[model samples]
Target: MSEVFERYERQYCELSANLSKKCTAAGALDGEQKKQKISEVKAGIDEAESLIRKMDLEARSLQPNVKAVLLVKLREYKSDLNNLKTEVKRLSSGGNYLSARDDLLESGMADTLTASADQRSRLMTTTETLNQSGNRIKESKRTMLETEELGVSILQDLHQQRQSLLHANNTLHGVDDNVGKSKKILTSISRRMNRNKWIIGSIIAVVIVAIILILYFKLK
Candidate 1:
């Protein structure tokens, strides 16, 4: 990230130097060179803006005390980039180049200082807001982490309960199988007892009839 910032700074410095040279020249730049330079400057500005946005996100991820200082620096970098873009645009416009160049050379220092002071003032005024926003982001992330942990805990408990229920169901099935086997044994025993009772009664009646026939023959 610092590398990105440094690259942007170098490109801005080069653009500034080129603009200063053009200011000193009494004539217009070669058409092709001017167009290429403008294109390069524009690309540099876009890259710088992209880097600054990344820096802003990095700052927001930090602690509030650290984020506040970084936010201020990012704002300053943004302001400087805006100023450079304005100067590049002035340099690229052929019709107003002379007047713009003269004005830039004359008032650049005072204008930069003034812009710096104004940016500092604005940053100071918004420090509390920036800090508050950083704190909110920090809190939100913390809450999300806690919620994720809680969800994991709940899933673990549910899994444990499911395992317990499965064990209980298996035990119930084993008991039911044993009860079914006991009922089948009892039914077989009952059928055997009924068959034996009928055979014993028939044997007793046959013996009594034999005794009566023997007594009657002896009396005759």
Candidate 2:
């Protein structure tokens, strides 16, 4: 790895880890304290973004094989960063709404019917928000599952293709072996034909010579 890439990657990891801790800590805190931690997280997010950009630039500058691997890692980092931001937002919104509801319930108001109406309305709103968040979580899970299944399907296809290639290669080898055998058989047959031709010629020549000797004897 290049020095710049290594440095930026290390820094990004540290920053993201710290942001995750902050996000988890924010869940334990409330009011101004939680808000402060969120602010800090947002700042860290900005810094992480900068580091990611730098790392991307460095990764792109590398060789193709190395660049692909590094870019994959960078995408994971980006996903994690996005998740962190989402979590922080969820925590911030939930805490603020709950805190406000609690304050309202604690107030000493004389209009009991209006207070009841307001409380019911706030409860309904909070319930809707929770439902929306739950729906979003469910959707995210579905998407992740679909992605996993797709990856598995692609791997299976590649495996089948590899098997097909191996089978083709084996068949080709068999054909080559048959071709070699056929060549040897043809060569042997050609040699036998040549030998038979020579033998036939010698027999004809001997027959003609005997005929000539017989005629000469008769004439003598």
Give TM per candidate. Answer: 0.46, 0.45
The residue-by-residue lDDT of candidate 2 on 107-211, one tens digit each, is: 422243244334434434544565577679889999999999999999999999999999999999999999999999999999999999999999999999999
Q: Go through the candidates in order and give each one's C-alpha lDDT.
A: 0.64, 0.74
Residue 174 of model 1, lDDT score: 93
Best candidate (score: TM-score):
1
User: What is the per-residue lDDT of model 1 for residues 1-220, given as tens digits with 9 covering 90 to 100?
Assistant: 2334334434434443343344334224546766676677677667667767777776777778877877777767677667666666556656543454465656464376356446545544454455566679889999999999999999999999999999999999999999999899999898888888888888888888888999989998
Off-target runs (Cα >4 Å) in candidate 2 are 1-108, 111-124
Candidate 2 has what TM-score? 0.45
Segments in model 1 whose C-alpha atoms lie over 4 Å from true places: 1-115, 125-130, 217-220
